[model samples]
Target: MVDLQEQAWAALLYVVLMLVQQWIHWIPGDLG
Candidate 1:
């Protein structure tokens, strides 16, 4: 049970980090 929750949280964190990375790459393009 707890293990499942931990995996879910890890997946969520990974997705959020990916989105943040996308934004970081995207913003430079918009400004430049």
Candidate 2:
């Protein structure tokens, strides 16, 4: 059970990280 929870958390973290990258890429200016 603990292992499954860890995997789920890791997946969620990865998704959130990707979304943040996309969000920055979409924004205009020097941050991309």
Candidate 3:
């Protein structure tokens, strides 16, 4: 059960990081 919980958290973090990266990339495009 603990392992499963850790996996879930890791997945969530990965998704959040992906979104943040995309947002960061978009900012430069918007500025230009």
Candidate 4:
């Protein structure tokens, strides 16, 4: 059970990181 919970958290963090990276890529042209 604990292992599964840890895996879920890891997956969620990975997805969040991916989204943040994409946002950073998209934000530079108009604002800067």
Candidate 5:
């Protein structure tokens, strides 16, 4: 259903944000 799709999208967004944060942390002096 639409609800499931929405949930999946939200989860994906969360994962992407986490990855970006991790990448920023890996780089020195990024200060993200």
Candidate 6:
């Protein structure tokens, strides 16, 4: 059960990180 919970949390963190990266990429002047 603990392992499953950890996996879920890791997946969620990965998704959130990806979203943040995309968001930054979308904003103008963010490339610098």
TM-score of each: 0.77, 0.82, 0.76, 0.80, 0.78, 0.82
Choose 3 or 5, whichever is better by TM-score: 5
Q: Please write out the lDDT profile of model 4 over residues 1-32, one tens digit for every residue.
A: 59999999999999999999899898978775
Candidate 5: stretches off by over 4 Å: 30-32
lDDT score at residue 4, model 4, on the 0-100 scale: 94
> What lDDT tens digits, residue by residue, belong to model 5 across residues 1-32?
59999999999999999999898889888553
Give the lowest summed-lDDT range of ten residues in model 1. 23-32
Best-first order by TM-score? 2, 6, 4, 5, 1, 3
lDDT of 2 by residue, 1-32 (tens): 59999999999999999999899889999754
For model 3, name the residue pairs that clash: none
Q: In model 3, state the lDDT of residue 11.
A: 100
Query: Tens-digit lDDT track for model 3 on 1-32?
Result: 59999999999999999999898888876575
**Candidates' lDDT values, in order?**
0.91, 0.93, 0.91, 0.93, 0.91, 0.93
lDDT of 4: 0.93
Candidate 4, residue 13: lDDT: 100
Residue 3 in model 4: lDDT: 100
TM-score result, candidate 4: 0.80
Backbone clash total, candidate 6: 0
Q: Is 4 or 6 the stronger prediction by TM-score?
A: 6
User: Residue 25's C-alpha lDDT in candidate 5?
Assistant: 83
